[model samples]
Target: MRPFEFHRPTSLDEALALLARPDARALAGGTTLVDLMKLGVEAPGLVVDIGRLPLAGITLESGSLRIGALARNSAVARDSVVLSQFPALSEALLSGASGQIRNAASMGGNLMQRTRCAYFRSHDWPCNKRVPGSGCPAREGANAHHAVLGTSDHCIAVSPSDVAVALLALDASVAIAGPRGVRHVAIADFYRLPGDTPVIETVVQPGELIVHLDVPATALATRSGYLKLRGRASYEFASASVAAAVKLEGGVVAEVAVAIGGLGTVPWRDRGAERLLIGEALGDAAVDRFCDALLAPARPTPDNRYKLDLARGAVHHMLARSRPC
Candidate 1:
């Protein structure tokens, strides 16, 4: 890794001041940023340590779930309140990295995690996301894990956050603090598609630091689960994963939310599928239609075309498992 000045700030104001400098990056848990630096994918001149700041609380005020950015992934997954209120979120966290990693990775660091695309990581490859205008070799290269939805000609790398998929299904929002001020951005709008400018990944500004995550409680949260299909049972990223939350009233669907990861450029949420399942019985026809709603617009590459079928079965199975019959 390149040599860089490290500054540990105790207060938010002091951290923001350090981040104001050019090529200055915030270091929360050092889970993702540190790896990228070692790979030479990212190199910042100044690293502002935000781990000492008091932002590691997990609160459930009224009905909403409030998670501090510094909260560890394992703590959130093992929290009794989170397990009872948002099982899908807990499941997604556990489905990801090993227990050791979960103990060290922070919620904010997970949000800022980069894609696991092979081309993007290898400095030898011509990846548009790694180096703008270099051209994306993944568009025609070995793309067995590339995205099928929300992809642009410039890039097709999939988003690699398992917990973020569950968060999106819960309609979560993030509280961001920057030089301008503090503002809450909905999770749906946080990620940007790999458009012509694949370099710009998210809505987060240069100096903005994610302070907290806001997940509003709903009946859907009580009846939810996450399913991940990977090459192995553990310590592997999902080839196609589904986070499903469904609420049924009198054997009929009342509310539903579903999001898929490892199948899109971002944590993919299909409101159309949610709308189609509302007020309808969970029958084969309804389930088929729901799958169609989610996978109709998918345009997969030749190598990863099986992801379409895997996603369909994952959606069907996740909803079936979430049923409180």
Candidate 2:
């Protein structure tokens, strides 16, 4: 990693003030940020260590699960309330990285983690996300793992967070703190699509820090499940993954949410497709139609066209598994 000044703040206020600097970056678990720094993709002159901040807590309050930004992934995955109330989130967290990583990775760090695009990670290639207007090689080059949904002419890199997908489906919100004070952003609005600005991936301001995430304790969230399909059995990024929740009322679907990852620049969700399944049973025919509508906007390259089928299968499996026993 490039030589940089590191400051371990003893308080959130100190951390925030340090992070307000233009070239400062917050360090939580050092799982993702450290790797990018070592790759030379990220070079921050000031590293503010927020690990000592009072942000690591997990609690159920007012019918929502509040997860502190610094809470470890393994702790959240194994929390009894999370396991019972938001099993999809637990499953999603467990499916990511390895046990050691889960122990070290923080909730906010995972959400803020960059895409795993090879071109962006490597200093040898020109990537739009790394350096805007330099051009995106993945658009016409080796892009078998690139995104099918939310792709623009500038970038096709897929989102790599499994828990973000699950949280999107669960209707979560993130609390961000800055000079303007704390603000809540819905999961749907947290991640930005790679339209004309592939370099800007999220709504978090430069000086802001994610404080916590709140997942509403709704019937749909409680009935959710996640399914991930990858090239390997372990320690692999997903090729296609689905997180789905369905609330059945008298044998008919009452409420539903479906979000997909590894197939989009951000966690993908189609409310129109969800509407099609709102009043119907999750039968194969209805599920097929839902999947069809959900994948209708996909623009997969020839190399990654298989992701469409893989995403469809993942949706089917997740929805089926999410249904009441």
Candidate 3:
């Protein structure tokens, strides 16, 4: 990695001041940032170490979950309150990275990690996301793992965050602290679609630090699950995955929130699919309609038509398990 100045800050204000420096990046878990810098993909002049800040706690308040951005992935996954109240989220976290990496990875770093696309990883390849207007090589190359939704001609890389999929389904919000002040952003609005500027992946302003993740109380999430389908079993990125939280009352679905991962530029939420399951019983018909509407516009390349079936199966299987039993 290139030699860079590092500043460890004890206070949020101190951290913000360090982050405000031009080309300064935040160092949380150092899982993603360090790798990119070594690959020459990211070259920051200064790294503001926010690992010393008091943002590593996980608490339950007002029946909601408040997860500090600095909270370790393993900590969040193993937290009793999170495991009991938000199984889908816990499962998602547990399924990602390895036990060792999870122990070091932070929630904020997880949320800000860049895409895992091969084109972006290779320095020789032209990628608009890495170099604006350079051109996207994944368009006609090995794009089996590229995004199927919200993909523009400039970029087709998918956001590789299992936690983001779960958060989207649970209606979570991100708390950001910056020079301007603290602000809350809905999880849906936090990630941006790769329209023209694929390089800018998030809505966070420069020098912003993600403080915590705030999730509203939801009965559905308590019984929800996340299903990830990958090429291999133990440690591999998903080819397609589904995160769902559904609440059933009497014999019908009362509430349903669904999001798809591994197949979208951002964590893809299916509001149309959620609406289809609102009053319907959690059965084959409901699943069929939900899958059809959500997967209709998924424009997969020649190498990834199998993802359609995988995504469908994941949704169906998750909902079946999520149904009241």
Best model per lDDT: 2
The CA lDDT of each predicted structure is: 0.90, 0.93, 0.89
Give candidate 2's whole-model lDDT: 0.93
Q: In model 1, what lDDT does residue 17 have? A: 83
Q: Write model 3 residue lDDT over 242-294, tens digit each, in one string.
A: 88877778888888888999999999987976898888998998899989999
Q: For residue 95, give model 3's deviation from the true position in Å.
A: 0.5
Clash pairs for candidate 2: none
lDDT of 1 by residue, 118-206 (tens): 99988999889889999999889999998999999899999999999999999999999998899999999999998898888888887
TM-score of each: 0.97, 0.98, 0.97
lDDT for model 1 = 0.90
lDDT of 2 by residue, 91-124 (tens): 9999999999999999999999999999999989
In model 2, which regions exceed 4 Å deviation?
322-325
lDDT of 1 at 44: 93
Worst 10 residues of 2 by lDDT: 316-325
For all the candidates, what are their Cα RMSDs to the real structure?
1.2, 1.1, 1.2
